[model samples]
Each structure stands twice: as C-alpha cells, then as structure tokens.
Target: MRYVREFKGFAGIRLESDDIGTADDPSIILLHGFGQTRKIWEDVAVGLEQAGRHVINVDLRGHGGSDWPSDARYDFDAYVEDLRAVLGQMRTRPVVVAAMHSGWIATAALAEDAATLASGLILVDPQSESGAQSVRACAEELSASVGQGLAKPDYDERLLDIFDVDGSGARLLDSAPHINIPVLVVRGALGSGHRAENSTGYADAFPNAEAINVDGGGLLVNAERTEAFNGLLIDFLERKQPRFIPEYRSGSDARTLRDAMGCFATGITIITAHDADGKPIGLTANSFTSVSLDPPLLLVCIANNAGSAETLRSAQSFAVNVLQIGQQPVSNLFAGKGEDRFAGTRWEVGEYGAPILPSSLGIFECTRNALHEAGDHFLLVGKVEKASFEPRRDPLLYFRGKYRRLHFT
Candidate 1:
C-alpha cells in the first residue's frame, strides 16, 4: 500500500513523499539525484516493500511534488538542512538511500549525528565532488536518458545556477569522517572517469563502508541495473541493520531465482522470419548465441507461447538482427502485442530471403539446421548462410531485465 505524506523541511517547506508499506516494517527513505524526481524510485520502492521494508520515496525542496521555494534557495546548505529536518520529523530512524547529487546532501545531513538520524546509508553512483563541467554532463545525461526532445524539464531551473557544485564536493569530503554509520556505495560506469578516484576516497572516508562497481552500468544504476541494485541493497540492509533473520530455502522463490538469472548480461537481438503466407514476423529476444564456427552455426531460444514461435520453428530461413543502441524502440515494438512491427520499422530482405533490419549492428541470415525442446522453450539452431556487420556501431545490451547501452569508460 502507498500513501502520500507531507513533512516539514527547512523553513517549513512542504516536502512530499510516497509513504509505502506497513509502518511497522523498517523504514527506508529514498532521495533522487539532480534533474530527477521521486518517480525514479517507484520501482525501487516496490522492490524494497516486497523485501519487508517500508519505503518513503521523497521529492527534494524544488523538485516534483515538493514545494518549490519562492526565493529560489537551491544551495547545498538548503538541501542538507531540508533532509535533516525531514529526518527529525520521522517517527523511526530509517535507512537513507540517496543517489548522485542527493548523496552529498544525505552525507552532510547525517554528518553531525548519523546514528541518531538514520540506521544506515546507501549511495548509488555517488560523486563526492563535481565541477561546472560535471554538472553540465549530468544534465546532458538526464536529457539523453529520457530523450533529446524533452520540452518540460523537471525541477527548478534556478538550481543549476545557484548550487555550487565545485564547493559542495570539498564540503562533502570534510563531512564524511563525521558520519560513522554502515554505508554502502554503489558505482556505475560513469564512476570510472573524473569521479573514480574521488568516489573511492569518499567511500574510504566512512569508518564502516563497502563499495561495489557495476560493470557496464550507467550513472543511473537503479534504473539500469535495478534487479542487481535491489539484491545488493536488501542484502546490505539485512546484514548491517537486521531486524528479523530470514532464511531462503532453495527453489522457494521464483522471483528470487529469476532475479539471480538476470545477473548474466546479454546483447539484444530481433529474430525475424516469414510465415507460410510470406508475411514478415519478428520478436525481440536476448536468448541467442553463436553455437559453432566450423559449420558457421548459431541458435536462439524461443518461448513456446510466443506468437512467432511456431512460424520461426518451421521456417526454412530466418535472420537474427543484432540491434544497436538506437534500436530500443524497435526491440520494444517486436516484443509488444497488437503492433505491425515491420510496418513501423525499416527493413529489407536479406540475401538468404530472410527479413533483416537495415540499421542493425550485425545480421545473420541462416537456414534451419536443428531444433530441440528445452523445458518451456525450444532451441532453434541454424546454419549461417551469410553474416554482415557494421564495425562502427555499438551493440544494444540487456541486463537485469532492463535495456542497456555499452558505456566505455
């Protein structure tokens, strides 16, 4: 269950938050980064609640549902004080989870008395310091993550002008030693560049802290590697701030098992072929691999209940279109229901008479070689008749049930 709750922040500002789960359960306060709202934590909140934690997903002073100050006081101190006030208003000391820029606020808020204000702290893709260039890069990333055409931007625009990113980093480093609580720092691919050394130093400043770097994960770790992040979060919570001990029996939870399997990352592909009537049929799939090189063989596992499964299984020829980063919409269209996937996409017939996406990173036109039933899915093996690829493009990636892009850091 989720309810809207309001809290008093610095100077009596109304901070809006989604109060989820039972109040009796241990509480978790979620804070999003700059240019992002509490909506980012919607999925993470549900996951935390399911793992027996009460979640309070909140909006900062000038973002989302929270009150935007008339005077435009978007400085670092204002944010820190707002968080401190929110903690003071809470009935229970909750484990505070902050991401990116908000991590600095959370750190400063709990610096003086972390034990009294919060149980534990978790920072996602945090940076201890930032310069003007870093701030601009963050804004650019936020725009790219949604789309280049986002017209109405979230949060008060004054924030960018008012907050001193360069000074905030140095102040956060000064405050880190004062915060002596259990801390977990999660770094993504973005952490490898300008913030790598500084983030490591920040995490080490904590008296009791551990850090984990996620490979191929972007700055938005919770959004990209959600399942993996949740797993790490819950595990950290259980170990550091245990309320009740729970043991998991093997094969007990299907969700747990599925989440475990999601850790193994794979590249996205679209399996395309024509039906008996010569109509194009395709579906998005990540269950693909190169089987052998001697005879040039490959295989893709299709679920038995898929709409195109039967057609693909008996098709004399088929094509695997390895998607690039720009083809996420195409992947979603093929994976969805009641859509003319081919009509919306630009594709052409391959040399082997199989439909192929013209803009794909790679294309494998093949003829049916073998088929094998494997539980709920069947493996369709094919002899590669022709293979074409574009070396300049980066392949689309999938991990932890979310679309990913190759991030070279």
Candidate 2:
C-alpha cells in the first residue's frame, strides 16, 4: 500500500513524501538530488516495501508537492534543517538513502546526532567536493535539458540561483567523523570525473563506512541499474539496520562483549603523570568513575600492556583531565602512537606535581591510594587531593566506540 504523506519541515513548511509499506516494519527515507522530484524513487520505494521495510520518498522544498517557500530560502542549511525536522517527527529512526547532491544534506543533517536520528546511511553517486563553477555547469546543463524538453519543470528554477554551495564541501568533510552510523557510499560512473584521491578521502573520513563502485552504470545508477542498486540496498539494510535486536551471552567473542559494553556512554579523559625520567606521559581512557565522595576517591582502569601503565602504577601522583568539546584533537593525540603528546598540548603542573591540561572541562589531581590487577588491566585508584571544573563547558562523550557531544533537547 502507498499513499501521500505531509511532514512539517523547517519553519513549519509543509514537505511531501510518498509513504509506502506498513509502519510496523523498519523504515527508510529516500532523498533525491537537485533538479529531481520524489517520483524518481517510485521503483526503489516499491522494492524496499516488498523487502519488509517502510519507505518515505521525500520531495525537498520547492520540488514536487512540497511547499516552495515564498521567502525563496533554498540555502544548503535550509535543506539540512528540513531533513532533521523530518527525522525528529518520525516515530522510529530510519535508514536515510540519498543520491548526488542530496547526500550533502543527509550527511550534514545527521552529523551531530546520527545515533539518535538514523540507523544507517546510503549515498549514491555523491560528489567529492563540488565547487561554484561545477554547480553553475550543472545548472547550465539542467537548463539546456529543460529547454530541449528532455526534462520536466518539476522544481523551481529560482533554486538554481539561490541554493548556495559555498563552504559546503569543507563543512561536509568536517562533519564526516561525527556521523558514526553505518554508511554505504555507492560510486557510479557519474562521479568518475572526481579525483580518485579526493573521493577516497571523503569515503574514508567516516569511521564506519563502506564503498562500492558500480562500473558501467550511467549517471543515475538507480535508473540505469535498478536491480543491482536494490540488491545492495537490501543487503546493507539487513546487516546494519536489522529488524531484530542483537543479543550477546557470556563467553561469546570478546568483540561482541566489547560492543555491548560500548552501549554505555562515558566522559572522555586523559590520565596524565610524569614517568621516572621526569617526562610527562598520558593516555586516553574512558573507564573512569568516582568511587566515593566522602574520601574523594576515583579510579581509572588502564590496559596492563599500555605504554603508560607501568609509569602510572609507580607514580605517586597523577591527574585525570576530563575533556571538553574543543579538545578532541588532544584526546586523539594521547590515544595515538609515536607522538609527543605534551609537545602539542598546553599544560601546567598541578599542586600534586601531575601534568594537568588547563583547558580541560574538569581536572582531578590525585595521590596514588591503591592499585589492583584486574584481568588484562590494572585498576588505579586515587584519593582526589584537589579538583577543579569549568562550569560553562560541555563534556566530550564517548559511546559505541565513537566520540559524541552532549545533545540538548
């Protein structure tokens, strides 16, 4: 069964979508590229519904049945906010599938809160980084096609002049690492002209992403290779956005158990102290908690084989620096190998002689209270001698093995 559905988009604008399949099933939202309407997803929607998924094929602002804003606001941010509004209104998080230029909107919309918005993402023939000249060329081609009656005037022509692509590519690149959900990038012949290195870099930016090349498929892979594209889509959905929940019993693979543990979000921290050689050493850790308030006790678990584990164990004092949103690069530097972590960071000695990252959201200077050996790791408990926190800063969070920011309602 299929019917038309209306959604309240950015600024309460009415956006239209083709609602297919039963609502009980897993859901998917399909977004088309510029100069196209939701009608382009007709065949794909039917295929997804038959495969036990609900589908919402959307018409962006100024296209198809959706409201074309009288304000003529067709900027990139408008499109991004529209998608986020649609996701917020959905009963369940759906896997978003976008083609060509729409991929930029989908990625930007989900970048900040991917785990909360959508379960997965699929990009079809996404551009690496389209410049102003490339966009103008595309507009000229679209106009020529429309003049020759090769395309229908289904969208507003004013969008060509108003839709801004400036700085969008760089923003997309910076947003990639934050979109931690499963992403499938399907490259077709349409983007063959894009530099291979840039294309690879774009796809690799996502922490959890896969890419496939559809050779010989024309500009529009969905239209030219419908069957093949549908096959890949179904397969990714089954694996990443499965209908059933995953369960892990004891004694299963350690990886599965680790994944289960990753579900619990924790604040990121850097355990810092000076080794016997009077050199500052630190490593990123999330296994930290305050054990007692009466005695001001806290504990951090470190892998036994870690380079800093021995030094930290013998040290009389150490500092736990709770990171903030601006210190993600610092966290990476401490976690990474073969880098002078202190050389790249700003720091000062705490009252307890421990290296404290001054800009951290919170700092706990502690004296070594106790140490115990846990399986594969050592528990380093400390008696907090002093503590300081920045009340105005937000914490950096970690969840499901990915970095996340605190999302405010």
Candidate 3:
C-alpha cells in the first residue's frame, strides 16, 4: 500500500500502487467500487505487472486507509477534484481510467473532459440509476452504509465489506454516450448491474470504442476466474497495445530484423512444453506458418529455451494452439518471465500430454513429424490435432514487428 501525495486543496484518501517504471509508461488508475478499498486489486496488479503495465489501485474517500472529508457534500465534482489532484502527481496527459461502482462516478466526471486527461476509459459494471429521486435515495443509502462501517472501525474484510450487494443502476452510470474517451466496459456474468445493451449504448456513444462480456464468472469475476479474466484482459490489451517503431536494435542496424519481417507478414506463435525433468517451459517466435490444406499441418520454430524445446527435440510430441489476434500478452506470458504462468492461465492437456489453452484457432496434438536445425531455433513440425476456431474473428498478423487488427473499415 503506497501513500499518494495529497493535493493541498483536496481532502480524500490517496491510495496508490508503487508501479514505478519510467514516468512515460501508460498507467492504469483503478477506482474501487463504493464501500471497497484498493486491496481488491492485488491479483489484478500482479497480472498487469506480468503484462508490463503500471497499476494504481486506490481506496476512495471514506474507505480503508483514506481520509474522509468532514464536508457532507457527497457530489461527484468533489470526487473528480480529488482525482484531478491524483492525476496531477501522475505522469503525462491521456492516462487510462478504470472504474468500478463509485469509481465509475469519478470516471464519468472526467469523461466529459477526457481529451484533457485520459486516453482510454474502462468502466466495470456500474450502478445505472436514472432519475434524481434514485440518486437522492441511493446517496442516502450509501451514506448510511459507510457511516455504519465508519462507526465500527473493525471492517477489515474489504471485499466482503464493500461488495455487500448494493447492486448496479443508473444513479452511478452517467449518460455514457456523453463520455468521449475510448472505453472498455467489463461485466461479470452473474450479479452484474449493467445489462448487455447498456454497454452497447456506451460503445455506440463513443466513436472509437468497444465492449466485451466475460463469462468465467459477476462483480466478483476477476478474482474468481483469474485465468479467463486474465486471458480476456490480456487479449484486449494486445489488440490495443500501442504500435510504436523502436529507435534501436541490438544486432543489425541497417535494415533491421523487424523491418525485414515486415516485408512478409507472418503469424506469431509462442510454443510451450515441459523438459525431460518435467518442468514447464516456453518460447516466442513469429515463424509459425500454415502448410497444407487437405491434411492441415502447421509448423513452429522454437529457440533453445530451457522449456519444452528440449523436450520437443527428445519426445517429438506436443500441442500447438494457434493464438487469435490480441493473444500476444498470453504469448508474452508463456515466453517471458515468471515461474507460475501456467497457474494463472487456463489450459487442458491433449491426448498427447501437451497443454493447450481452451480457445485457439488451431490445436495440433501431434507426434513429432520432423525436426531440423535452423539458425538458432529448431523447426518442430506437428500434424493436426482436434482443431477449433471462432470464425469471423481473425488471427493476429504480424510483419515488420507490428501487430495489425484485421477489420474492414
């Protein structure tokens, strides 16, 4: 739990995360639901860090570890003012805003001025109370609930305490169409307040935005089905991951490898397997190419990572799960750091004893067809296993080191 430096003019809890990377990295500021604190985001922070993003999950005013103002004026402007202060200390313009419940209130307050403050907005299932009467009644109920908790002071259970079933409504959801930032609304499958069309309404309002519905779990979804939620979040971020041309490359300076790869756009794949010692391992490569129509066979080139590569060379059996567009984060997870990436990801073993993510464009449970030496990586061929794919949603295509979302404008 990090303390946020106070804004002299504002009076509220300044909860912060120590996501101290470079000052310029895009940041996510999470606002907890009403009656909750920043602690609810612990697992989320871990997932975001693994995906290489800084996250700040904070306790709003009148909640855990934050200061409650003596002023009874509980209007949202005051909350927005508090956010302004937090954003002031935060780096650069166009920050990302993620809000749930009461945090949605703060997000809406800022959406009217998004170009001035944020690049994107993510609103979790929010309260959507419409009329002034509903707002007044909801405000009274909200005040009493927080007052009761404040009177006691032993409210240590942040999740159970804050998420005690207030349910969502329009009282909290601003006229979403008025929100100007690119928005991503996340709803739990159960106990969610915002209806499906409600999100669509918000999406329609914003010219450059989309909405996603998750089924793994409600308001308690993210922590419940961490893997599915993580996968979905990862997929979303990868599709949204900024495409930037880096200034320098280590080996070849002239044409650059990325530029060369750009010439012949290819499919990217991250292959994984256990070593002879039965330890999990994986690596990333863009050399995954389709080869054949009648039999349906695919190929992957694996670098000499301690992971399944060695085992593949020896066992000659593995599963190839072709990733759809925006699955780059999962690929990175399998390719990059951490000893427990599999634990957080959902997968099932194929008949051949290889693990594969449940949803993939192609699933190849094959005996090692052949292996050949490549430059530094090995070409491991796999025959088709039980394959499945969601038609219309295209697989991600890469070339010259850029990921493009295939959609007709």
Best by TM-score: 1
Best by lDDT: 2
After superposition, candidate 1 runs with Cα above 4 Å error: 130-136, 146-151, 189-199, 217-224, 246-409
Prediction 1 global C-alpha lDDT: 0.84
In model 3, the Cα lDDT at residue 187 comes to 56
- The residue-level lDDT of candidate 1 at 59 comes to 93
Residue-level lDDT tens digits of model 2 in 104-209: 8999999999999999999876767644234445545534432233266578878977877778888888888999999998865233333233335558878899
lDDT of 1 by residue, 240-285 (tens): 8776644446859877666667779999999999999999999999
Residue 69 of model 1, lDDT score = 97
Q: Give the candidate order by descending TM-score.
A: 1, 2, 3
Error of 2 at 154 (Å): 0.7
True-vs-predicted CA distance for residue 374, candidate 2, Å: 61
- Model 3 lDDT-worst window of ten: 154-163
